[model samples]
Structures are given as structure tokens and as C-alpha cells.
Target: MSLRTSFAAHRRTRARLREERAFERLLARAPTVESAHELRALATRR
Candidate 1:
């Protein structure tokens, strides 16, 4: 594999990890059952 390809892969992995952490934080403070359901739907779409 090329260096550029590896770097791109690493960047994508980091972004996905960041998004997952943000989503977890959202779940933690979701507020209401309806919102939690909405989160679930969003999660499934991902």
C-alpha cells in the first residue's frame, strides 16, 4: 500500500471514532423517550 492511502485510511478512522464519541454523548443526555427513539433511528441509518 502507498503512504498516501494509509494516511487517508487513518484519517477516516479517526473521524469515525470522533463521531461515535459525540453520538454517545448525545445518547447520555438525550432528555426524553421520543428523542431517544429518534437517536435510535439515526443510529440505524448510519
Candidate 2:
């Protein structure tokens, strides 16, 4: 509820969004078959 905690949470959210966007871009740049394989591997690993 404090201003400092709220600001920190906002920053964390922004960082997560940026990371997700970058990961999407990474996957977008990969070749189709390779991307599919990589995504599957990541899914199982998760």
C-alpha cells in the first residue's frame, strides 16, 4: 500500500513484460521447425 512498494511492484511488472516480449521476438526469429522443437523442449522443462 505504500508508495515505495507500489513503485517496486510496477518496476517488476515492467521488467517481466519486457522479458516476455524479448522471448517472443526470439521465438519469432527462429526457423519454423527449430522453433517448434525449442518450444516443446521449454514446455517440458517447465
Candidate 3:
């Protein structure tokens, strides 16, 4: 595969993992407005 394709695949995988981890963390935390906002911000930064 070309370098571009490899990079794209890597990015997609990393993003998926990050999303899953973030969801798990969010769930572990209480369902508060502050936690929700923090999750949103963390996702946006990624």
C-alpha cells in the first residue's frame, strides 16, 4: 500500500480507539453536565 493509504488507515484506527476509550471514561464518570461538556471538548480536540 502507498504511504498515504497506510497513514489514513492508521489515523482511522487511532480515532476509533480514542472514541471508544472516551466513551468508556464518560460512562465511568457520573452523568453530569460538566462531564458531558468535558467529553465533548476532549472529542473535539482529537
| Predicted structure with the largest lDDT when compared to the true one | 1
lDDT of 1 at 6: 98
Q: List, residue by residue over 1-46, the lDDT tens digit for candidate 2.
A: 9999999999999998997788777777778977767875795676
How close is every model to the real structure, measured as TM-score?
Answer: 0.80, 0.74, 0.61
Q: Best candidate per TM-score, number?
A: 1
Which should have the higher TM-score, number 1 or number 2?
1
Task: Please write out the lDDT profile of model 3 over residues 1-46, one tens digit for every residue.
Answer: 9999999999999999997897878757857878878877776798
Task: Arrange candidates by lDDT, descending.
Answer: 1, 3, 2
Which residue ranges in model 1 land beyond 4 Å of their true spot?
Answer: none
Among all windows of 10 consecutive residues in model 3, the one with the lowest summed lDDT is 22-31
lDDT of each: 0.93, 0.82, 0.84
Candidate 2 Cα outliers beyond 4 Å, as residue runs? 43-46
Worst 10 residues of 1 by lDDT: 33-42
RMSD to true structure for each model, in Å: 1.4, 2.3, 4.0
lDDT of 1 by residue, 1-46 (tens): 8999999999999999999899889988999979988998989996
lDDT, candidate 1, at 29: 91
